[model samples]
Target: MTASDRIWQAQLRAHWAVLSARRDTAGVATSGLGILVGDEAEILAGVDARGDHHLLVPAGGGALVVEDSQAAYIRIQRCVLTIGGRGRTFVDIVCHRADLSELFDDVISSMLTELATDSREQPAVVCKRVLDEWRELLRRRGGLLGEDALRGLFGELVVLERILAASDTYDLSVWHGPDREPHDFRLLGGDLEVKTLGMAGSMVRVHGIEQLEPPDKGDLHLIVVRLVADHDGLALPDLVERIRPKTNDRRAFAAALARAGYSETDAEHYRDRRFMIAQVAALPIGDDFPRIAPSSLVDTLPDEVSALSYNLDLSLLLPKALTDAAITPLFTKGTLS
Candidate 1:
């Protein structure tokens, strides 16, 4: 996927528009991108205009994750940066919500217009908001196997970064250098580098390959978020594990023993535990393995873009009446001689 095709682009456009319009008003600093606009009061007022409550989905692209229609809001939390030469400046927005009451009607109205338009091809997933930015992305969504992998990586990155920041204490401090490797933060001073282990309910054997990387020297860390899915694919409840892998690797085997209270030495000794449901462990450093750092989390993940939302799906927000016009034929006339 190109730079802007991600869902964040949609929120970026709306946010940038809001920020840009305020440029001309008096008392506003012309700091360009350096000017921060993430005043919680202003954001809260705007979101409150749409609805009373806003859900928190750290993984969402500044998007809202509320129960269906209860809180109609979409907010993209982000840290926008503007770098000049060597200096760096940033505007961090912790998006609470977007009051959709006013905009929803208009957004829905536009769908009415789109339905009248004449178009024959299927409605592509190119987010109109950022199509201009991601002109390089031409792959079809489901057709290309790689696309899903990339999307999942992007989604995972968004989730991970947000979780780190959402903690009671937040810090954007991360290590990077001239090498420009994707996730090579080989700084393991007192931190731990981790990999996700077993699943929660299903029978698939769980042994993390990434964790095999040499442990960070001292403090570096890595976090693994594993979701244990049941037969139907829903994440099983709870984050504890009952079983573990049978391996010479003691660390891997320990979990199984702990969960099932089984001795590590027995043959087939891994079967005693129930396994983890859905757990996310953050690693603070990297190992000797080429590029296994928190920054490199994206590189390790598969590309896939799936939205975890509660109130409303973005697709529905777009409206089917409009999509029908773009993807399906409005008229069909047949006459045979």
Candidate 2:
């Protein structure tokens, strides 16, 4: 077995040993805090006087409880019953006896590690963040996550990485998180909305009418990325890994990924599903561009229409497609008014 696997097994064995010794004891018994002889971090576990099992992490913070009716994993401040008055929290992942075998050591280790990583944060905040991440992962696992959205994000990352690699003046620091801003990317020059077209079609989806509306001061451009599903092409995770190194700030890039509803743990599931880029077209949104903007109409529509979304035929915009070379200059320098 690998070193990590061996260490995890040792920790699990130690935990079980402590529990077995206290199997008939009246009160809770702990494996103690701090790193054990053959493990990383503290290996803590115990059974309370009332027979409730507990797993303690001395460095844990936050109050988070994730459950589906019966089973629950709770994170709270450390105190009596397990490792009393330790000033550290014990986040316990409680499961039924029948499900005990399904509770792998690595899963518990991952939780403990995640909790320990954010030890400085308040318990509630950390709990919420972890719970959100867990829910996102579950969403992805259930196939509720959008595949088209992921592809679109990958395309945008491709363009962002290209811009970063080609020009030193193009500051990615101004780039906004996915779907957070009106446009996909907010560069120093202006904002660029990235649209990915999959399959054989000239149609591109405009999420909302506001997407086509340029910022008040600067220009806006639409980047149309044509992709084809392929068994051997690059996947979303591949694109993320490629762009991660190109980014100026790694932490910011990670936060951007989080905002995009992506987690590293969930990335592996999408690793093999790939797409090949067929073409990339950049079009400047000008007065001539066929789009509906709030400023275009003086009076509101009679129906009070909201969340307007439509598909635009790119074949109609073919005449206005800017040369690929022209795309670089639009983002290379500041054009903010």
lDDT of each: 0.26, 0.60
> Alpha-carbon error at 39 in model 1, in Å?
35
Regions of model 2 farther than 4 Å from truth: 1-144, 170-172, 177-179, 334-337
- Winning candidate number (lDDT): 2
TM-score to true structure, per model: 0.23, 0.58
The residue-by-residue lDDT of candidate 1 on 1-337, one tens digit each, is 2122223224434544564454442322222211112222111111123222221111112332222221113222222222333322221212222322222222222221232234332111111222222111211232222322322222233232332333323222221211222232233233222233334321211123333233334333333434442454321111112111111222222222222222222212222222232544342222332333234455544546222111211222122122222211111100001
lDDT of 1: 0.26
lDDT of 1 at 219: 38
Candidate 1 similarity to native, TM-score: 0.23
Per-residue alpha-carbon lDDT of model 2 for 164-210, expressed as tens digits?
Answer: 87678755566674436778777666778888887777788887677
Worst 10 residues of 2 by lDDT: 95-104
